[model samples]
Target: MQNNITIRGAREHNLKNISLDLPRNKLIVFTGLSGSGKSSLAFDTIFAEGQRRYVESLSAYARQFLGQMDKPDVDEIEGLSPAISIDQKAHSHNPRSTVATITEIYDYLRVLYARIGEPFSPISGKPVRKMTVDQIVDAVLKRTIELHSDPKEIKKRKGANHNEIFVMAPAIVGRKGEYHQLLQDFYHDGFLEARVDGKIVSLRDRIPLKRYQQHTIELLVDRVPLGWPIEQNKGLQQRLTEAVELALERGNDVVRVILDDGSEMLMSTRFTCPEDGFTFPEIEPRLFSFNSPYGACPECNGLGTVDLFSDDPCEACKGARLRTEALHVFINNRNIVDVTAMNIQTSLDFLSDLTLKASDAKIAEPILREILSRLTFLVDVGLHYLTLDRKAGSMSGGEAQRIRLASQIGSRLVGALYVLDEPTIGLHQRDNARLVETLESLRDLGNTIIVVEHDEDTIAAADYLVDIGPGAGKHGGEVIATGPMPKVLENKESSTCAHIRGDKQIPYPKKRREESKTFLE
Candidate 1:
């Protein structure tokens, strides 16, 4: 197998008959002054040829949509791989596009929450759990057994052999506005009595519930004694089952069982709250995606923010970009909005701390792994401060480029040619080391990375260096020096070598200018 990408007689742009052999699967830097044809050689010539070849290998129908690339003016080239370019261009300008959306982290978050998220009432702050008819029956029986086993309660009861239990369906609870139609429906259903706001009211009486105030109403199903003798009675079990079914039907799949001790239990046939009437829809990955209408805030259309004149928080969703119900769903006491709002580092901590029961671990393991891997890649590229909801358009050129780099690292593709243009464009000296380490990590993954860079640290750290200038523009485009770092620096004819060897230097200011208190004219 060929171990190098040999480029011969390449004349793309200002490059003058360039020919070189860049070692494959290595961190190779093309260094020189600006406009010295480093990008020309790395991107325009080599990357273009590699991409064009791969695209041409596809079906003609696919080629039309992809658009054909014109062949570069090169005599011959060998050892090319499928090419991927990571430049300084932002991935998108759509207001709905965010860091999480771009990296697909938000999609996984939705699935995780939907599958395992606990739903609670926004108004009452009570958890809602769905249960089957059998579950409700079992719960009532379990409570009865507990009461019978209590020594103090048994002593209080004395010779009493039974406990009376009230089976009721919550028709309404803590909701504002008049429900006159609902009252009529309950009356028509042959429910002779109801407990409205803790008052037992006859259905015949015209009880005017305040139209604007919140209220609770329960329809009386049956009152029966729960004892071993009562359990043996076939009619009692039948009545209990009928009461549970009636409650579920009348109370929107939820039922409340009240014991003689005044204790209450609520259960549902769906993920719903009988007390608060909160319902959770089925969870899927798309439900968390702002790009999809199912999970997107209807007010902002999943953009999170809105544009009245300029970008501002969305009035409908208050900038969450998800429906209120989605926001109400929680895992570990944090909602979807709260999780996406965290910085990468904080999110990593949260995810690392996340624990799943053994039962749920099998389902959650792969999903959590994928999400954490992408987040780790983002952190490795020094984007720990970026929140998941940060808009892509708000990123700097270098930041955007690094995001693409992070995404590529997460992809884990091997034996590919990656051409990056000025990846350190806006990075501070403090951040350059991490950037260099990131690039080297990619190279170590069996990828050939060709970086067009002017950063001294990057050039120094390169496994192989090609300095393509004695000067810029018309005076440049020749390979002034090519080899390992030491060889490149030792070449007298290379201007970059002269600087690296300390034979030449960019002069610094003799004295720093003093700051003026007032604006200069």
Candidate 2:
């Protein structure tokens, strides 16, 4: 394997038979005046060749779907690797695309929350618990025993030897519209009767429920009497289990058992609050994903903001992009939406202090590590102030470029040629050092980095420098100098060296402008 990228007779664009050897696994900068063919050489010639070669290696059928590139006018090249370009292109314009979505941090967050997040009641603010089949059955039996054991209650109910119990599955509850299709489903599922709006009616009886009015309906599974010697009745327990299971499968994880005395008991096979009858949907990755129906806010459809004449925060979810139920679920006293809304630095600090149970720790360790690493990458690239919910389209060119750079760093791919265009275009002087360090970190990972930039700080930090011009446009394109930083900085023929060696300088203003009195007005 060659240790250098040898390019001979490259005449792409304005490049005039430019030939050079770029050392592999090093930070190389291409510096020149604007429109002086720096991009033409780094991106068009070298990176383009690498991409074209990779695409050509695929099958003809596969190539039809991919964009084809014309071969560069280079005579010969060696030691080229697969190339990736991180430019100033925005990732997406869709409202659904956020910083977390684009970098895939949200996906990992979804999985972590689903696995260990504790659900609380939206109404009562109490921790919800899921009841197993045995727990549900035990509760029912205990209630029956307690009622029969009360001598005063038993005497008041004269000749009431039979305890009437209605075993029912919730078909629909508090939803608008006449559910004709749902009624058909209930009848087809072997239900003979239904309790519609608190009225027991036969399935054959056509009850016209108002289409626009909210209603509650339940399928009558069975009607049994809780007489003496209830333990001997095995058939009653079997029927109870079947009804509860059907309700859990068909309903939103709840079943209602109405007693003769007008009291009711709610049973659930999911995390629920018995007091408020609040139940959560099954825990899955999609439960935390705003893009999914299970978690998306109904008002804004997971876009977080609403378009009401102008863009505004959604009233229903208040820009969280999740339903009230989802907001109730917490991990370490913070919900998923709250966690995603935190800025990168705050999120890192929050995760550092997070504690989980021993069992939860085992499941969350690997996922948490991946999330922290991606967050660290964002912080390293000077994006610590941005939250996960910030839209991708709202980002500036430099922020978008750095985001792509951070993603590449997370990939940790080796033996690749990375081409970047002005990654420090809008960065502050203080932040430039962090960006430079990030680029050096990529180089240390056994990959070659070639940047097309005019930043003096970037050029000064390069391991190898390629100055492509003595001037811009018609007067440029030929390589004036190519070597290590010290050698390039000392080249008398190179115009780039003139500025670096203090021979030329951009003049500063003699006097700074003062703020006008009317500026605030």
Candidate 3:
């Protein structure tokens, strides 16, 4: 049991020198005939007091961060929870908040999609080939070494300088498990075009040699080197890492060295190739690396989403912030909001203001007039959409409220305490139940809700009822009836209680379809 809350000399709104002690942790509903001080008790009395004390308890730095709330005009309130108040009040401006983004679910889904989704080439639209980073590194190294070595270096040491030897490399490794056929395909297509001994020959032009007749020739790797990548315009983070790795791979050695610059030096060793044992096959370098920036889709910046210029402004504003030729006029830069806010009403109005007449007035006149003329039509056409440069935090109340709901909805935080006032104030009746259902979901999250509502549908469904009025104004405030629906009706008092009770036993409050009559009784 909580320490009982005893209200002495209660004088908020309609409460006439009243006092009461209520139980804690109970789903105590405080219902009332409209305008009868239920709101004063729940919001102004309890929630407001709690909010004020919380603000005062914070440190100066924290207080700076927290928004202030005016204290309720009650004498005292105590034993409040570490409370959270959710109301129909909308959120402040924040443009980037969207349903998917506000809820963290979008981030989880993005990772899942990136990992398992099928990928296609951005340029050719072909299925992307998958390879481990190490495998790719190996292939690049092989191609790099082959290209770097000069056949002249081998000849120069072997003293077999009859003619030049052309070292060659292919653009693609033969598709795995298809090497022999790949050679055959290359020969058929005449892809091997370069020469050794000044005679152009296709490497795929195969001539088989019998192993028994073959003289031995050993081709050993004199040196193994890492693959060096060439890139430009990369961000500083990646560039710095790339530079460190590149430094690690630099130096001259006694064995054959293949520089990424495509030069090769053979050390002091020679291999005698029997004129018939080995075949020289030619292949060009394949540049099919996915991680390369050149392979990314240029438009999306690798994010896979494209942007197009929007024809209309955002939905927040219809457009007009002002009339024509206003003080905020800049024919080139001026928008109607600037015109309206800048105190520029008309070009004539701008000219008439003698205060503005003294400085740069002549220069300011034509610029103002031209803008005013365009804005006149824009305003008529309902083009008062937000300007290109509105702050995300300073939007109107309605826009902010919707954005707050959007944020909470996005958070995916289930089971919240949601309190709403007249959420439908600016909305048509068609919009009410939707708001009610939204409130219901928040309550369903195991929250204790206390709505101060006039909407009959919502009020009718309360689990408990406490109607707090005989009437509005100074005449109201006492808890006229406090019980389940059946008990409230037996009493002669509550106007709301009387309506729901259907007392032909008693008269009802004015309904919209009824004949107008003097005296509510």
Query: What is the C-alpha RMSD, rounded to one decimal, of candidate 2?
Result: 8.2
- Root-mean-square deviation of each candidate, in angstroms? 12.6, 8.2, 24.8
lDDT of each: 0.80, 0.82, 0.41
**Tens-digit lDDT string for candidate 3 (1-521):** 25434455556777766556543333335666667887787766766766677778889889888877776666666555434454445443343332222222223222322222233333343333333322323333454445436634432332221222222222221222323454455456544432222233446455332333412111112122232332221342243333223322221111222334434332211111122111111101111111122222333322222332323433322322111111112322332233233321342243234244334445445544444433332222222343322333554444334334434443435433333444344444655555556545545554445566655555655544567777877779887876555675678877775566665345466766877687766
Better of 2 and 3 by lDDT: 2
Cα error, residue 396 of model 2, in Å, equals: 1.1
Point out the higher-scoring one by lDDT: 1 or 2.
2
TM-score of each: 0.72, 0.76, 0.43
TM-score for candidate 1, residues paired by index: 0.72
Off by over 4 Å in 1: 133-270, 307-309, 514-521
Instruction: Indicate the residue-level lDDT of 218 in model 2.
Output: 84
Model 3 residue 81 CA deviation in Å: 1.9
Q: Report the lDDT tens digits of candidate 1 across residue range 204-304.
A: 66778788888889887767666465445666677777889988888777677777666666667876655554555445555676776667888878776
**Model 3: how far is 191 from its true place, Å?**
44
Q: Quick one: ranking by lDDT, best first?
A: 2, 1, 3
Candidate 3 stretches greater than 4 Å from native: 1-35, 55-60, 101-120, 126-130, 138-418, 422-446, 473-478, 504-521
